[model samples]
Target: MIEYSTLKQTGRFIIILGIQILILNQIHLGGYITPFFYPLFILLLPFQTKGYVVLLLAFFTGLAVDMFSNSLGMHAAATLFMAFFRPGIIRLLSIKTEFEPEVEPRIHVMGKVWILTYTVMLIFIHHLSLFLIEVFRFYELGEILAKTIISAGFSVIIIMLTHFLMGSARKT
Candidate 1:
């Protein structure tokens, strides 16, 4: 029997997945701007989550998206990389002694600057890895770089907007 918290998490995951597939996936602007809503799952995870669990979830999350989009394994590789690096990124952004034990990654708790830096770094890493993997051959390095940067920019904007909206609700 699953606990209530576990059930709630499962529901949240499903809802986010649906939003990613049914909504965000259709908002692509040519090949340059793809809003990556899946990263929110990674960003919203509990601060104290285990590394392995994070990695597995990231891999599966990306794989699921890939499966739906027919993008092969690129998303899986990129997301797994982000998940693997997430803890380290948190540590790098964190003040260590000042970080709350059970806090989630939010603008309210970590401050806007920290959250912005964290999102930008992770989004860049994820987009770089994803486009590199998709392009495989470096013959189109310029194109891939352009796509990655543009897509990352759009994703970061969406992420910050989502954070601000959600944070405001939490404050009220």
Candidate 2:
């Protein structure tokens, strides 16, 4: 039988992807900001999850979005890059303390500062890689940077809000 956590995560994966493809993908602020809170799905995975498993999940998650957005493999590539560095980032952030194998990188569980730093770093990496892949032009570096900064900022806010809402909802 499937574990409860497995089922829960599967449901969340579907929901987040649905929202990204159906709702958030439609929003483009000044053509510079498009929130991709879908990365939060990857960020929230359990610490014990194998690196290969995380990479596979990230690939499929981003591939799903790419299929909808028709941006080729930009999402998949960006997400893969982010997932590749997730473990190192976690280690860097928790240099003084060790996280439990099953502990997820959630704001309430990990504290605001840690979660903020974690989310910001990963989101920036994902955004920069994504925008760079999308543009693929050295001359447009400035525009890409602008988009990455603005989009990462917005994505971080949405991710934090989603975490708070999910955390509170789970309490009741």
- Give all TM-scores, in the order shown: 0.90, 0.93
Judged by lDDT, which candidate is best?
A: 2
Q: In candidate 2, what residue range of length 10 has the lowest lDDT sum?
A: 95-104
The runs of at least 3 residues in candidate 2 whose Cα sits more than 4 Å from the true structure, single-residue gaps closed, are: 96-98
lDDT of 1 by residue, 24-128 (tens): 888869854778878888888879766787888898889899999899788999998888888888877776734444567888888999999999999989998
Alpha carbon lDDT of residue 25, candidate 1?
88
Clashing pairs in 2: none
lDDT of 1 at 147: 87
What C-alpha lDDT does candidate 1 achieve relative to the native structure? 0.84
User: Over 4 Å off in model 1, which ranges?
Assistant: 1-4, 97-101
Query: Candidate 2 overall Cα lDDT vs. reference?
Result: 0.89
